[model samples]
Target: MVRIREDDINEIRNKAGIVDIISRYLPVYRKGKSYTALCPFHDDHTPSLSISEDKQIYKCFVCGAGGNVFSFVQNYEKITFPEAVVKVASLIDYPLDYEADDVREKIDPHKETLYRILEDTIKYSMYELNNTEAKKQYLEGRGLDERVRQRFEIGYNPPNDALYRFLKAKGYTD
Candidate 1:
């Protein structure tokens, strides 16, 4: 996953017009002060998607689909948020690539090892949680479903030396 700076995203949002981008996907027409288009998100006989150029936003009254340009592109194109940002930047001819400072160069070298250790521990804990029925039951009792667990990488580390053994196996020094 590539990281896009917030400034670049905001710049694309500011430069691109909501109506223009939406119009590229579907027909947009002048309706009073705002623009109107048939909701592409849902089956519709009339124009229900209201696009406000003043506010730089769009909203579908019937299905409640709404957002700014990046979100609109994301939802409509079924692409990731970063992909949508890249697409929008391309649409308006905004340069997306910029040299970013190397963060690793400034951080303590030991920090990377610590991060790896923590990451490995998390992975081992997640494996334990999946294999342990009691842990799964406890998560369910707390209303944490599989979806939430997977989303948050929720895991458990048993009160044992398993984690230490796992780390040692991965060649981590004490």
Candidate 2:
């Protein structure tokens, strides 16, 4: 997965017409450079949801539900930011590639340490299974391929206390 570039995001913003997208959920009427629809986030008799196609943003002016296209979809669909981006991109027939490396780099140090410990544990488990013919045969008989195993980070944990000892030796505590 690759991160969505800044230029690509701008393209999404420009291509996903605010009037067109909002009309899909509610009846929108053109009012000069903007559009208005009934506020879906709150009960209202008059149209209060204002959408600016020029600004690529929406505002309720009633319940204060407002933001750009991405945020509007996020609130309307009750989905995450990335999901909203994908939804908007799909609406405009735009392609997107997702990457988690940036998010991982921003996580707390303690969480990063836990991730490292789990990675080391997986390596240790794989090493421990190197000589276990029975386990290998079991996995193979189950129709698992080497590529699938590697992709899923599958590893064998011995029936004994080897995994615990390995973690202990690596300075991991319960």
Candidate 3:
């Protein structure tokens, strides 16, 4: 599950036009301000795919399949969402720097369990910090604001067996 930044996704969408991308796959004819092409999604069509260059979207009136540039590539190429994003970016020659600021080291196969446990622990701590007002106040008092906490990946460990219970429920052993 590679998490791409929303900003990068928007930028790519803005840069890549719906008409340009769809035209690469099929022959589209100008119909007023919009374009029309035979809907590849279904059989025997007379230009049912209505592509709006202004809206940057496409709709197959027969099949009811419609979406943006990324979705068009995704469906057309039969690729995953992330792969479609990369494909769209490549098509427009847009450089995609989607990796997070935190440079995580690659985990060894042997240490996979440990890595999962660490990730679970982080999630549990984050939940605790969010739910516990006292914990939030303590962090705020110590000058750890929301932005600072988010930047540092700060979290709180509640004074209870919550973590133990959470790990147990997740099937992580001691």
Best by TM-score: 1
Off by over 4 Å in 2: 1-3, 99-174
> lDDT per residue, candidate 1, 38-78, as tens digits?
99899988999999999999999999999999889999999
Q: Which scores better on lDDT, 1 or 3?
A: 1
* lDDT for model 1: 0.90
Candidate 2 per-residue C-alpha lDDT over 1-174 given as tens digits, one digit per residue, 9 for 90 to 100: 336678877788878888888787788988887789998889978999899887788999989999988888888899877778888989888877767564556668788889988899899877766668888778888987677777877789878898888888888878
Number of clashing residue pairs in every model? 0, 0, 0
In model 3, the worst 10-residue window by lDDT is: 98-107
Q: List candidate 3 segments past 4 Å from native.
A: 99-174
Tens-digit lDDT track of model 3 for 19-42: 988889999899998999998888
Please state every model's RMSD to the true fold in angstroms: 11.6, 8.7, 14.1
lDDT of 3 at 47: 93
* Number of the top lDDT candidate: 1
The Cα RMSD of model 1 versus the native structure comes to 11.6
Give me the overall lDDT of model 3.
0.87
